[model samples]
Target: MNTAAQPPVGEKVRCLACGEVFDASISVCPVCGASGEWLALYVPETNAFRRESEEIFLIVGGGIAAVSAAEAIRERNRLCSIVLFSEEAVLPYNRPMLTKAMFDSLAEEALAIHPRSWYEEHGIYLMLSKRVVSLLPEERELVTDDGAHFHYDKCILATGASCFIPPIEGTGLAGVVAIRSVTDAAAAARRAEAGQNAVVIGGGVLGLEAAWALKKAGCHVTVLENSPRLMMRNLDAAASALLQAAVEESGVAVVYSAQTDKINGTETVESVTLRDGTVLPADLVVVSCGVRANTALAQSAGIETGRAVVVDEHMETNLRGVYACGDCAEFRGVNRAVWPVAAEMGACAGANAAGEAAVYAEHPVPFTF
Candidate 1:
């Protein structure tokens, strides 16, 4: 007797926290770790317009923005060649999960934004561990660090951002780390040991998350904020107080108005000395400073850059046929550098590049912690 096959088990769901669309079977948003409450049933609008062409679409950086651009392009054009270049050795994954789920087993398969089979089925080429060193906009060509060259009809620069580590003495210590990538998170996790003293510099959301993760790993975690309060930019006074209480209740110590003079150690991180002369014993130090947009490649190509590469509403750069999005693109002098904004900008850029009309509108970012 023949048995009936099981129907598909998951539907498309949009994460409210980061605007990432994923299968609903997943309990938490793979991008931002938002629970089911932040997920909404989503039915993608089918674009009836399709242009079959041999044009090559090139995307730099393997972040959410690059993935979204590829998806948007595939949605509009089925025959175009799409190639994505990434300096990372692995496929695109949810970056926010790096800090939010620091201690978890982040196997590439579990963290990937889309499975490897997804790229193969969609005809998108994955050029991993390839860093684009030069952009020749006039010739519509790109040169990688390894001297490989590729030509494109249209290009999107989503080089994203790099973590800014402040100049502090002893930062080169072995136990001092920053949480920026899966590899960085793994290094931090390896250093987090029971009964160890972990000092986290910066009291932003990312810093707090790392502190909590270290605390969970049985490390004595202390968060040092240079500002007067925690998340001063994102939270009001009352909310900040409430959050501070909650964080302290979770067994993580919080310090305000902290200025680090230097990290102290002979070989590894031994302690952190504040400007006030108070020294906090630390076995490991995690720096959660902010990030700066990666705009050197665009700047070298004569692209206009203020805080980042300037872009119009369509996410197109001053150079025609070239576009930028994510942390690398600044529109109206604003770049929130958030996941949702990056995804929206990338979708807009991809649509316009595919000969479809799409505009990006700035919106207020929703904060969920």
Candidate 2:
């Protein structure tokens, strides 16, 4: 069982999915349940290049990018004050596991990216459940929703992204939802009753994962894809065909070129109506549309933004002393909102924010089943 206590030091492994470090003896990640194959030997970084400074580093968001930025900042400067603000009530967690381990008892401790002791020991002040409402680049100040203001010398924005919900009727119903946070996952799991019908809109990787999770919970699952094939953006025709075959073999129904018209129900989801007039009964509906980068805060602060907050190779925005990374940032007109890219971008942003030169090189983002 995962707890708030720190893991034993020495010879540990880190979960690539959630960046949770634990004893190497553990076969599966206690936090995300990722297999041992995803574990890597954890080697603690030495502060050999430490440069003492009093500059305050403020990181906004509670995702892996925020945590990575904090770690990078600490590596180069030990005495610098690092303040992390997360809107979530719980500590930063492994977000990708929400659908992958939907049925697991994902208490705060189990989902935490690192034990609370790590932050305490590193002197990283965590302001949980605090939403930064405004950013004043000129004043180097930020205002939270509670009217509290904070000042920083340098700031990193890892505000991440939110799940995009396409316009569809009846989405406000109780059983119709999207899997984004732990709370969403828990709600979906509760609705995944055995022998009940669950309809998933979108045939992307996330939609498939959610479908499989509901199927594992004994729900009759059906996936709807507006495109002619599954994972159209990621998989070619041959690969998509192979994946569809495998998915259908697992007892989940797949419908191609299925455009949803609306969700049908009163207070709870009862069924989904397709544009072709086909109705699929659904006790629960999960929307797996793509995500949109959370760039409103950056844009409102007069930062350049196209699809997301535009940044240079160093992950620095147009404004000096300000940087953006993770899903909320775009480099060279591309923003691959993946874990590896976010981590790399955060490291570069943090390093540059700490008076060190760092460059983020563009690379092909990899996706796995």
Candidate 3:
């Protein structure tokens, strides 16, 4: 775990009112008897109940879902020794801030969800920059990138997604960037500079975000979409129109239904060629078209996979003692790969992975606000 990513030291845990030194799991303030916004989530299956909790291991991919799930499980099963592992070098940080970090150096402290110290204080064993390579669901064992093995009463797969790259001529050209994680953001920010002209592929949320970052970098940004409208999957035509107008107001150029044929550049991406014989000039290109579930690792381990890792509403896979969630898992064909569903799915999977019966609920759609 990165020590810099931990929570602030000596953050007082006081009741909302009366300011009592309370030490009980009461939703209402112990002294004031008022229910304030104190988020202490729990799962009874893995928890010790009247005694202690069952020790569990949580394997996370890059995203907030795993973090949310880990917190929920940690609060309830205080006795459980949680081993938090991430493939990313950084500890659990606010991943959404990656877009902002692309153009500006967002403080590391501000991005971190819990610093290394916070995990230590909470008694969680943090394995930063570690990857879980194999899952032995039958033996309840798992292997890491270094061939280290650990047995779990249960396991979770929050492997998230991979950057979707469409096959096109000259797609391999350099300066073709993808913004999926903090590492990607940092790299893009360095590659992209002010006064550069950037062409962005995809009209999804991430594409728009990348355009914003590029604009802030003083680049003239143009967005090219294969779809007829932006955010077609998430929003209706009316909402898309409003969002398009709002983004256009920000000085972003939008090209609708652009079928890209190839990238143009001898050594690096200098422009994009469309199927209609139109060329969009650029100094750099960023792709945020969409994401596909990262199920290769799971597939290698012989776990069942559908469009994604096939899991039930409870986040359980076909195999016992193994669970999947977040962007990687498909629950009853529900693939709302946003924060809310991923968080709920990951939390449910983590709690149940500790030898407890935990069922997940269907998440709601994002509100059109």
Candidate 4:
């Protein structure tokens, strides 16, 4: 049941044209499109892993996906060694709360998934403030930003996405920001003071949430949406109109069908100019367009990727002994950047990595913001 790395599974399959090592099962090299004999397999001896030695499962990322994966792995095999590398200094916490309740006076410890002692008690190694730089799939190794090298029998990538800042001028101004991390939330809270003007770009969930937060902070808030309606992906015209009305009743202004040409000011941002020649005055602006998957590490390892890392039903990547989940992974060419989907994928990936049988089927239900 344990889908551990076996002979030829974790081996290097090189492309004759690109000279890149990809998955053997891939008939054509994902990089150069070489087919047939052009793809060659090379399996090495399993001397690196002794039967008596304990197996190690390495997870790169520090989000819901990574935390869920660790829990799933522990549930399957208590004796196996597990190391979770997180780029953030803090422990995993409720990410959604960062924007949803930015103004709420939440204590630092309250954000964590569990107390620091939980990982120790569960025998999970939590490596905080560590960023994995490169992946050597052929050697089953990963190198951290600090020059630390780690070897693993099975590895899972939960490297979550980053905010997508559009190509808008004046983003480098003093008050412009994106509410993605805890630190960002703190900054926004400090800036969104009473008597100040704030504009939020993008009418998505985060944008609307941020607008609400700023409004709650006693600032005059305006939401600029490029689309015709708010939450267009989730709500139809009628629903969007109702939601917009509700939001406006809360003392927030909504602008729709807007095309931002530039954010202008002498020093700090003073106004946002739309393509239609209308200008909105603002002291601060928050951009909440969307997010892009962190696929640089996976791509460097020759792992097949589209918008996100591609995975099979077992949550395993094309490369054997490797798996990917969360916003950073694409299933059947679609990436669902929602928390529920990420957690499900992570659980399936972790269970399979621990030699437990678990299959991941995409959620049939539709998502709404």
lDDT of each: 0.90, 0.88, 0.73, 0.83
RMSD each, Å: 2.7, 3.4, 7.7, 14.9
All candidates: TM-score: 0.96, 0.92, 0.82, 0.83
How would you encode candidate 4's per-residue C-alpha lDDT over 330-357 as one tens digit per residue?
9888998876678778888988888766
Best model number under lDDT: 1
Candidate 1 off by > 4 Å: 1-7
Enumerate residue pairs that collide in model 1. Answer: none
Candidate 1 per-residue lDDT over residues 1-369, each given as its tens digit: 758543257677888876778887676787777875888887888778677788999999999889889988998889999999999999998888888788887789878988999999999999999999999987899999999889999999999998889999999999999887889999999988899999999999889989988999899999999999889998899999999999989999988999999999999999999999999999999998998999999999999999989999999999999999998889999978888888888888999899887889888788754
lDDT of 2: 0.88
Number of colliding residue pairs in each model:
0, 0, 6, 1
Q: Write the per-residue lDDT of candidate 2 for residues 1-369, one digit (tens) a residue.
A: 876555565579977775656677677876456774799989976545567799999999998889889989988998899999999889888787888888976788887878899899888899999999989987999999999989999999999999999989888899988988888889999988899999999989889999999999999999999999888887899998999899999999999999899999888889999999999999999999989999999999999999999999999999999999999999999988887678778888988898888778876654633
Which candidate would rank higher by lDDT, 2 or 3? 2
**Model 2: clashing residue pairs?**
none
lDDT tens digits by residue: candidate 3, 178-263: 87777778777877788888998887777888898798888999999888888888789999999999999999898999888899
Report the number of backbone clashes for model 1: 0
Order of models, best TM-score first: 1, 2, 4, 3
Off by more than 4 A, model 4: 1-53, 365-369
Regarding lDDT, does 3 or 4 come out ahead? Answer: 4
TM-score of 3: 0.82
